[model samples]
Target: MTSHTVQIKLNGSPLSLETSKVAKQADGAVVVRFGGTMVLSTVVAARGPMEGRDFLPLTVEYREKAYAGGKIPGGFFKREGRPDEKETLTCRLIDRPIRPLFPKGFRNEIQVINLVISADNENDPDVLAMVGTSAALSLSGIPFEGPLGAVRVCMVDGKLVVNPTYAQQSTATLEIVMAATEDAVLMVEAGGKEIGEEQMLEALAFGHEQCKQLVRIQKELMTQAAKPRWAFDAKEGLDSGLLEKVRQIATPRVVEALAIHQKQARAEAIAAAFEATWAHLVTVDHVADDAATRVKTQEYFEKVEKTEVRRLIVDKGIRVDGRSVKEVRPIWSEIGYLPRAHGSALFTRGETQALVATTLGTKNDEQKIESFEGDIYRTFMLHYNFPPFSTGEVKRFGTAGRREIGHGALAHRAISAVLPSKEAFPYTIRVVSEILESNGSSSMATVCGASMSLMDAGVPLAAPVAGIAMGLVKEGDKVGILTDIMGTEDHYGDMDFKVAGTEKGITALQMDIKIGGVSVDIMRQALAQAREARIHVLGKMAEAIKAPKATLSEFAPRFVTIKIRPEKIREIIGPGGKVIRGIQEKTGAKIDVEDDGKVTVFSSSAEKAQQTIDIIQDICREAELDRIYLGKVKSIKEFGAFVEIMQGTEGLLHISQIAETRIRAVSDVLTEGDEVLVKVIEIDGNGKIRLSRKQALRDQPALSDKEKLKIVPASAAGA
Candidate 1:
């Protein structure tokens, strides 16, 4: 077997790329290793474009094998099932930046597969997956627009760290994944702790710098390991006469239809105009057949619409919704709409509507992520659901698709930055955003609704966050920036930039463009405009509920946290969890004990929570001298009676110390079923407790008038 390897030093670590040694039959394949993590990325394209294909059919899949982390798959199937959320998001991460790099009008069926074959449990392979996919595609014979690189940047302890390990990411205030060429950034996905725009820009620059090194490395590898170019005939464009005819017929009609503010009405008008033009073209004597005519006319009409939309935006600065370039749609928000939910909010922006609800739960409710990175518990989760009814369509219902996962992740990143620390808010939080209506920027609406709902649940967020989607239409030198863009602009525009942040700074931002790349200055301007719109949306949200509610809902569970010595964790848990289970059963509380000895108790009643805490405390607490306990009598004997003072603690009460006066027998004064107050008179060398009921009563202070009156019988008090 022939083997070729190239090694480079990146971020103080050695990265090795090997090809011609694995998956040799594939069109192009490479295995990349960083630290101890390894990923195999392979790319293949069909010999020629499929018939009737008008768009690039590209699919990217990222899978994690349980054995990569020295574990086994979980669930009834005991093997890998459908793609999880992380995997789905990773697929998007690989697809977004590379999708634009393919040649224009290239309709080949291309597939890229990334597999995590090995994991170090510290460094994640997702970033490496992107770089490897790029390398594989660069080596393929298919016509790709050259190679780019991806990198992960993190801000740790007031300093920027490139390619940080999982441990460092846990403490980093900012995390960003950037895809770029040597000069310009093509894609960015980031979440920050209210980081200012300048800082975010700096991070992007840092990431891009790292990407340059990787891009150079890829170039070197490509020089030695490139395949011969494939042969395929490019599809021909429409004839000039046909294009001119369609333009002349549809331009004026499309212009008038786009000016209508109502979505459904405008849609019908545009469809009617296109259908009329199509009918005219089909009736031409040169048209060969009905099916062929329909296809040609449909494609031509799309081109016409694209031309008209760009002209309207870049020349007239007019949007389909009739809003100005920078104007945001109308917004209305309300919280506490669901009485049973811990927090709930409904937010509507123009035509998009999101009903978001937040549910508070104990630690047991946290979502467990079992992956090659090891087990992780997610305490804050945001789920996005898009029903067919949201878009006024009739479609088959199924689980969350790739779009839902990606949108939910964006919203999660935007809101997670402002959430309070676990120590401040102990309840596990889950936010679900249901799209009731969608036209433009429903994901941004989800972000707004989630923020309002989180606050409604009394989650002391650092600041309220809002999101806005920005669009760009470029014609020649003139460029128009559309804020709060709708679905039509997103389809025909050059860029779809979604910016989310608080008033202080940005928390998250995701950008994907259909063009080659966007200039940095344009990105800066977009950020500034998005900030203004975000503040405006926040104002509307504040009117609904200015801040998080002062208190949690009455139905929500109350949580209390306490710290204990690590050594005592086992003692509290007992053998086979006997002691902890007993405490839960007795007090009706949910208990979560961490390895670090931080015990959190959750209960509907604050009183029960405190009671559970007391039980755990007694189990772990050391016996103290001179302290008294209301203990249970355990036995009757001639010499003394033994009393159970605390959980698993016993003290001997001698007959002589049973009461203030002499007693004939221990049974007369203290029976096994009776309760009595006893003082810890002494603790012996063996940790045994010595109790005295007489001394406990003797040391008790005399009751005052108020205390004495409380003991009066009801009949005597009334008389």
Candidate 2:
């Protein structure tokens, strides 16, 4: 057997990608083992691009079969078909970091696959897959500027740990998985127990420091097995000569043109300048101008719009909205914007607007998440919808595309930071954000609108969170950072780093660079600037509506829960849900029970919830007894007789303890319902009360002990 290995220090430990018997058919295959877990990754690129492709046709698939841990499929007719939630999330992790690393305009039909071969119970498959993909891509002759590496960092006891185990992640206050090149951060996804901003930044830095080593391993593998990368027919860049003309003509006038600030006024002035400047070239005398001149004239006009606008921002240091670099556009928000929605909010930031609606439901509404771990439940989910009309374009709205899923997921992560814990709000929450208008950062607008809609539904958020999109245009340290960037700035700028966060720290960040990679110093500066703008956005949100209030809508359910002993839980919820269903049917309420023996009752009305609570308590309540009762014999024995004392309770009356009248055969002494005043003597472990007809007479002191003893002895002798 031929064996090959590529080793590098990762997270301060020796890491290796060993190939011997894994994925033998692939163009380039390697088994990446991290800690105790392992993933087999293969990279294969087709001879050419899939015909009629626009963007780089890259496909990343991560699979976790049940047999990875030697387990079988659980349900009937077992087979794995759909990717689970973990698989979906892991696929995103791989796609995000590597998508940017591919050389721009390299539209090749490239596929990178990571299949979990084995999963040691303590290790994470996601982290290992990330490492394996980078290694495979590096060795596959793909024009990847990668060797990008990822690490999962979490805070355990306030100390950040590198590449934490699955167990450590559950209890950690922070869960951060970030990828980085040696020079700059490529991607980051973090959510947790409200980690501090400084700590999150520190975690990112630590993760990057650890990931550098894995990236080194990729470089070595590339040197060993890589083929010459494919070439792309590069297209000409923007015309500098024509752009210079427009910049010269429009740079000065932009200040006065944009001072009007309204979109209509500025667009008119820019349009008039374009028409008047090139009137003669397409005049009646030369209506059929040559193709080159016509094309050049059109290109000149396009440059005026793209460049002069940027030049206005760069040289004058002024924004098209007439604000300074650090300034944010105005914000306006309102809830109950739509009458039919269960809950709705209209969030407008500058020109971007989102009408968000929230709907809550019973367990039936829960989303079923299947992962490598198997089936799970997602009680809270957020979906975002963007119609072409949002951008004033006419198009069909139907199924969700990758862009929609990606955008929605970004917003989902941002507000997930402050969503009420399941313990506090048990309903399955679904939020849908409709992009009513778009100028820039529609996804960020979704984040703001979703928060407001949740509050409108009376969901108690940890705090109100807000998102702001920050852009940067840099050429050799002559950098301009635009806060709350608009559509035009985002198009012309080199970087669009969207940061969505709360006052505490960042919740979600997504950055796409038009230029290669931004410096770490710029990222830090962007982070700081994003933080300030986010705070202001949050403040404005609070102004419209503060944190979620205590009262839910009248149409919403009222929740009340009671904690009881775990053992008594079954009795409270009687046979086949007879007890619980009875309570709900009787009071028109809903109930959810937890394994910890907590019963939560929800109802449309408070009265209905209280009524259900009363019934549940009665079913589970213990009875108290003090007085004696007349009992009848249910069965006979040599020494005693079983008697019926209460509706559901039984008592025993011994033969010797019967009345002074001597009698033989217990049936002759007492029949069912013979009504004898019986005194309670003792209750046994099984809750059976012992009763004696003669004991009732002993309470009278006038009857001496000798008389009582004589009476009992006679009865015993007869028995």
Candidate 3:
């Protein structure tokens, strides 16, 4: 194979795809470069399908090397470990769009690997990797019904920007990643700041046009270096008569099982129907009862079930749970369910329920992430956990998997839009959602529970947020969009569209189509319907908690922020951190000082917090002219005496200013370790302080008893 390259100008940058230069042995390989960032994508398929496989065995891996960003790994091994959260998310971003493009019944094991070879730290490589995956699959001739294109669109200053750089995305109010073919959109994942549905539609349309341009470029590359088509024939392994018999035996019973509203009951009924169907075939028809025959029978039974479920929705307008197409399920919620937690909520919609808790910490609790671009610290975090018992299953517990990460990321994005700024809140927040029961849309449940929990914890959110999952059943021209879809609807439906936001507009959205694609009009309708459902959910949530609590929980820590001169930071920290440590130890408080002299103290008791604040203020206090202080004489000299005024501050008492009359020596009026009242008579430009005892004696008679009592001795001031 010889090297072939194609280039185009996109969004004011040179975008290029080159092939046959690296990994030639793989079925297909492409290196995609945009600006200074580059991603190498390769696809390889097994020669034969895995035995007994019933689904597509596809795996997508994305890795970022430290050298790509001109840095080395941080750990002791000095090498990359497992994929971090960002890499795992990017892998899911690349896999979701292309996975549906493969033909049905094609069970070949395919692996797609994307490596970030160069990172300029401006343009993100995830979108580029998505495009490269589609191009590589198209060029591989792996029966992929594609040549799709992907683009990132961001709305900045009321205008949409295509393929915006990382800096542009950071400031944009709305950011959307869309993938599409020439005619229709295939996938969409987006997060916004309460953007309206119409605005989102316009952005999606704008991004699709850019996708078409990339599709053309991929087609040109295929013309130059595409491989010959691989020979794969999908066979119906079951005998025609046996399949017909199984369908007849299972269709009625499956429909009866689907009528059951409860998830557990429906599952048991379905299982019984499957067993009865297989048993009847073996006894009444004298059919063979081998393992292979049982597998075929089960496959046929599932097909019948899927067909009947879709028929009930599309033809009869009757869902499995007997709800209208646009009706949302029942909702109930409670706040402050846990007395000890900072905030807690139990949100249940239909059969799905989530128990969410919110915890608040100081700046030290923020999560630090190392990425190709740079290190990032996040003050707000949301974690979603799905236990096996939630769905009535028994399984081993391990670390979070890809599904949990993806779901948590979606919910995190949804609730992030309404959170208060770090400066306003001054506390690190973590929200954890535990799924107690699951029938459908547990991720959306997490979103609702988190929002309520935050409000119950007294975290002032801009607005309440809620999420709903919408499903679609399309049979040719007949289309049914179901609101608040359950697990059964999601499994057999053609689309799973999750929308989350406040009453104003949408904050996060994710859509995946199982079929080839859907038109823009269908998407517009879905969004409109989702908005209606989202508003209804929000109304129910408001009934539980109208607004954030007036006061934080007693168990939560109290925070106080104060600003001081930048130079005074060293004074607060002291040499070897002894000063700050002393303050914390004395008052049972935690203090964090920023470089710009912003000090935040956290404590459980208000009196202790105030004590800590008073200590910091005294250490950072400056001498003021015309103000009098009680001073301690530290030393004596022939020319002048240095008197200690504020903590860590001293002033020079000139021999002449020491008394009303001229003194022969400084020790005549003041001795070492003597406490005397002095007034700040002058402050020089170089910060030299001059104190006079004669002026203090004249002002002492005019001072009120309350003002005199407010003054403390210099030694006691530091204490």
Which prediction has the highest TM-score against the true structure?
A: 3
Give the per-residue lDDT of model 2 (tens digit) for 436-488. 88888899999999988988888888877788899987756578998999887
Q: Which parts of model 2 are misplaced by more than 4 Å?
A: 8-15, 19-21, 49-54, 71-77, 192-197, 231-310, 319-323, 338-343, 360-368, 373-377, 394-396, 424-427, 626-684, 687-719
Model 1, 483-527: lDDT tens digits are 999988999998999989999998889988777777878888888
lDDT of each structure? 0.86, 0.74, 0.90
Candidate 1 error regions (>4 Å) = 237-244, 284-286, 562-574, 595-597, 614-630, 635-642, 652-672, 676-682, 690-719
TM-score of each: 0.90, 0.78, 0.91
Cα RMSD to native, each candidate?
Answer: 4.5, 8.0, 3.7
Candidate 3, residues 609-678, lDDT tens digits: the string is 9989998888789998999888888888898889888766789999988767777888666667777788
In terms of lDDT, model 3 sits at 0.90
- Best lDDT goes to which candidate? 3
Q: What local lDDT score does residue 569 receive in model 1, on the 0 to 100 scale?
A: 91
Cα deviation of 476, candidate 3, in Å: 1.2
The local lDDT score (0 to 100) that residue 684 gets in candidate 3 is: 95
* Model 3 bad stretches (over 4 Å): 236-238, 625-644, 650-719
